[model samples]
Target: MSVDSDPDMFSSQTTVASNWSKDERSQKDTFNWAMEMMSHGQYLPLKSQASLNLEDLQYSTKMYYIRQARLACEIVCESIAPSQGIELLTQVYQSMKLKTAETKKKDAVTDTIISAYKKAEDYTTKVQILSLIVEKYSKSELLSFIEGLTIYKIDAARKYASTHGPGQYVTPPKITRLRLSKQKIHHFIEFISAPCYLQVVGFGSRHLKLSSGLTVKVPKVIRTMIASRLITAYNNYCKDNTILPPCRATQYKIIKACAASQLKSLHGLDNYISDGMESIDTLKKVVSNLGTKGLQTSKVSDLIQSLDTLKLHLKNEFRSHLSTESDCSQHCMHFALSEKGCEHTHSNICQPCDRMYQIRDEIQNVMTSNFSNIEIQEKEELEHDILVSTEKNLGLEGSFY
Candidate 1:
């Protein structure tokens, strides 16, 4: 299937090489140009007269050779078994030096088979890749994929396989779309790219179910809507208005890439998810989990406001008396020996360092300590332990006396 091994496909005639003195690049150009001119598979002829004339003069090959090669590529490729195409390409390329008149004709024919083999390889690979990526595509996606390849790829279809080439054309010539205005396109773009599309936007997003039975929980502060929802909306709007909208590729590109600044990420809900909110949710679940799942906390919604308490405590209670230039060294020099300041080197926190020990202790209590039993039971247990110790000491005192 590979074309690189074939010798006759790009053979240089001795007379032409010696007299005309064309380089290897010129040889390749002439060979490809000749093959293209004779090809039936939607090859575009040189349009400009100057370009055409330049090619004819530059190539300067026999018409008979071009004809034989073209016929071998288009007519002969189909006439033989597909396996024969590869075989002929290999056989003629290896055996023929193409110095004599007969060998030159063999060389030209072999050149044709090379093109045929290349087409075969290209077709096989195209099918293999398309098999994997062909998903549930809306009409918009198909248009974007084949945007610029208008007549070229279509013309390159298999003519021999079917009775009619790619079936009959359905549309009338004049009714097809020509140029779409950017004026109309901007409407769709602006609709999807805006912060909030409907009246319910801003302040907070309320969770709502679409008519299609999909649930959308948008971000309270930022946009958390899915891209597919917007794409579906665009399609419906375009259909209702009888107007052409941009393809899904264009719509997706605008949001994911083109308008990435306006719309931050793909998963709309991830943008505003803070650790504080998550902690509050976890605590609320724990409170509800108590009482054998009967739920004691009636005001679970107010748990969200606990973040404000942490902030207030940090702002009001943490009184670090040290100035900007006064680092740990100056603060701890009175209580420590090392110039590195009071490393305080305590188990929990540094004393007189941040003055936030109470806040730290409270945070640790909420996060790690269990508050299941009431404080009354703990106080009773401590009192019992002290009384027992006192009794034991009194017995020892009596023995000493």
Candidate 2:
């Protein structure tokens, strides 16, 4: 019988049915009580509070309480139809009793839900609730929830690597070949932001499986960015410069700054060069048939050619040389004046410019060139004027003698 259709047993006591057949009564009683209690309207705030406060509990007990709470929630979810599940769950959840504690209330309840989610056997159910919980919690809480799930440990590791670098993490030593088969480049753009994807960027196995199930070969342009960041951070902070890795959260900032200009140009080049691999008409047909069982195949030369052009453009951009001083100031010109001064100017790179400058160079160094060898010529006219001014020695050297 449908849970909602059983109206004969209305009283709280009758819902347990003492005289009915044992098995039948047990099933009815359990289902009825579960439905009633689960539907109780007073526990929503309590359950939410419990999830918040669960984190501070001892690990073992914390795990137990969260499991019970999750089981209770899941049973309600599974037993009810999706159409009414949320409404009923919300109602019953309101009546549940919660352990009330002021301190760490938020963390405790979050911990409870996260622990329960970890032990949940139903993948679909787990994913659904976990996504909800993540959306509800703060970043720190969300990360905590992630830490509880073994599956997302990879993401955690990648986040650490982005800050601490690959050497600190157990990353593959190198990345050689790149395969780019995914239809959309937008996925790669998003991947760059994810911790797990960034971790495996330059080095290691060719095949990568994203949590979302879209697997693709790491393209060369992407790998270079990964390698450049890690290797530079390693060399500078770990050894040569003897400093901590660049400020936390700034690695991707560097990557984005370096890649932005390139992505724009790449779009233009792809639109221009991809004409021959397949006709536009055939290419359009294949795109329309993507992800279907009866899809047909064509040369796709036009599409592939466009993709290649994009890839090449990205490669060039990733490996593009940064010009240190594009517009030389008069001071720089003065510095570049004589052969000796010119050599000095060339050898002594502006600190800020050189730092990001070197990073860009290493990534694109594979087939790229360095900045043109020019002395920073200083404005002698200005310098001579300063020397000739009568107000030059404004300070007194006097009385000590």
Candidate 3:
């Protein structure tokens, strides 16, 4: 299982008091539970405790992973990273039968240890025993090595044998300041109030009533940012002024703190959402009136499916027949079929196709007229934008977008 990436956060992972059973519990069990709580950057832990099972060896009402984690670290002597140490402890967990949580039964690792012990008895003579298992000095010494495999005593012994020293580049990288000065930050606050970034809250005269009984109006962040757009603007400004910009995270934190309670961004999807509702409402009105004597009864799904099929079919259709030349077989396919089109003048005009094209165009015109009515809304929104730039300063005029 993956361990927490930022080990420093929970560095002091000392456990609260618990019974001796806590000491017997293996590191693997505790690590898995801790992993479940670590969700990316948000460190939210679930309150669900593992209920007691009578078959458990280290049986306790409450088992804290904090305590188990500390013990695992101590066993590894801090030589390994906590993640590496967890892997080493897993071998310990598998071999030590007493260390197994509920099983009291021996596992494969434990069985391997037992077999190695029985095999050691045959290595009775000192020199023969040395030859049998790759030239070890004594049978008793060899057996100790085999048993130490379970508890990782061998690893503990070799900890300093491979100790790493500081690298050649000991000096820290020289730091050039990138933090926005008080004036720049103040300029940033003013820059963001520009027409492109923010607008007045469109609530008109209406005031937001709080639980504290305070009434206030909020501003609309014009774009779905203090987003990429805001950052890009900041970087551009810094570049033009021949100064380095602070990191994105730093800028984000500063802006987020400023807008925490009062500002809300106007989402890009908002227009589509309103348009979608209007389209759905129009379709519903058409469907609802179907029962009246003049109208045909049909589902919205059926209409949509048929429309999709017709659109594909119409696009693929060739107006080869409309070509003026009688021998224009190759050139027929080249004719761009629409209300009007033919590289070759019409040898024969298609009345039926012409009528169909006219009807299609008419339907398109009607749909476009209905949908494109949002031009006024768009103009109004643009008017609401706070137009503030080096060249143009149209100070905060309208309420919101």
Give candidate 2 misplaced runs (Cα > 4 Å). 1-24, 27-88, 91-158, 161-401
**Per-candidate total of colliding backbone pairs:** 0, 41, 5
Tens digit per residue, CA lDDT, model 1, 194-313: 534322234555455677999777644332345666676667667856977877877776556422223344233322223323333443344333323332343333332443353332
Pull out the clashing pairs in model 1: none
Residues 1-401, candidate 3: write the lDDT tens digits.
32387665445353322444487755654654444434232333333445555355253433454454455344453344444766666665667644443333444754554465446543222222223332212233444445443223223222322332111112447988665678767766665565434444454333456679997766443333435556666677668569766677777776765553332522343443233323334333433333232333444345444434433222222211223342333223333323234435535554433333343343344334543554566434422321111012101011111
Assess candidate 1 and give its TM-score to the true structure: 0.21
lDDT score for residue 173 of model 3: 72
Highest TM-score scorer: 3
Q: After superposition, how far is residue 140 of candidate 2 from its true place, in Å?
A: 5.1
Tens digit of per-residue lDDT, candidate 2, span 1-401: 75456666455446566545565644445554555676673333222223346666778777766765665675567467655766677666654422122222455766776677678786544654455354444455455436555546434434544555432423447966544444323333443444322322244334456679997664433332344544343334334335334433444544554232222232323332222212222323333333132222332343334434433322322212122232322214333332233432343443332332232233223112321221223223322322322111111000000
